[model samples]
Target: MAEVMADNRVAGAKGDGRFEPIEDSQARMLADLYERHYEPIFRYCVHRLFDRTLAEDVVGAVFLDAARTIRNFRGSEEDEYRRWLYAIATNHIATHIRTSLRRRVLLQQAAEAGRLGPHDEPARTDGPEWPQVWRAIQTLGRNEQTILTLRFFENLDFASISAIVGKRETAVRTMLCRSLKKLRTQLKSVFDGDR
Candidate 1:
């Protein structure tokens, strides 16, 4: 009888492993992670790319990458997973920017073959100050823009931004301050021109 009971318990365990019902635990875990991080990630991407579609694409890719690699994640008390996720996002954004710039260059070359006119002027938007601010942001160097995005849009601390960008915390802070000053100067020029 004892032998039969032991066999039954083993079989039950095997069946549980093989054909277990879907549990809400994993869903809750994923939801919690997404809820906590999605907005900041999306904002970071949007600020970097200045396009909603590209931001959405990058954010989706980041989450997908996280899901794929989650199995290897070891449980930790520290928020290591968030840091890892941000690192992945930073890499993805960099790759996307490179590929997009290459494509833009190719498109420009192709269009030049037909002797087309210069590219049309950027569209005017409704916002009074935001468009000017955004245009000034575009003038910043890539690293400056990245530092600004991570610092302001993502609301990440210098340490977190440093971790993402593989720089020292002090360096990141200095970069952010310098970038902000540059942006301010650019915006001033824009405003001066508008007057």
Candidate 2:
């Protein structure tokens, strides 16, 4: 169609002389994927970083990186693309955290601006346990935190998680079980007290 052609997203024509679908083209596919997944990715970053402005910045950076690297992307399926995006996001967050001084400075600024902490905003109306759970998740290591976030928050299966985390599916499953067990133990006192 004219609209698809205008976007400069068509990779090439098929042997049948028909143009490939816009979604099949690397550039256009990323455009479509950005529309579909940006909000969820932002939400994940928000929960991961606990800072709205920083999360927005990170989301922009993630998509920008995706745009720059899309030509090299080999994902043939939508889910694969999703995993790839999350992997990129996870790596970015890790790199951000590794800069201890910069992270501390940012956290200080956020705190001074009254933008830090999960309690600054109500995350859900469904339960009061949301803040408590966030606190518990924050106490976890990077991989454990990422695994829990992808598994419970994103509701991704082990296979997708394995792809995102660069681990075997069985390893992902085992890690998830261990992470859940640790989270339970970490939160046991609060849960027991609530009972």
Of the candidates shown, which would achieve the greatest lDDT relative to the real structure? 2
Tens digits of per-residue lDDT for model 2 on 1-195? Answer: 324455454556777788765554566677899999999899888777766787898899999999999888887888888999999999888877676557745664554454445666654444435545666676677888898899888888888888899989888788888888888887886656653
TM-score, cand. 2 vs. native? 0.74
lDDT per residue for candidate 1 within 1-195, as digits (tens), equals 112232233212343355433344544576778899898788777666655677899999999988877767775633676777788888898899788886534434543343322236453433234434555666677777777877777777787778777889888888888888887687665546653
Best by TM-score: 2
Tell me how far candidate 1 lies from the true structure as C-alpha RMSD in angstroms.
7.8
Candidate 2 clashing pairs? none
Model 2 residue 122 lDDT? 53
**Which ten residues in a row are the worst by lDDT in model 2?**
1-10
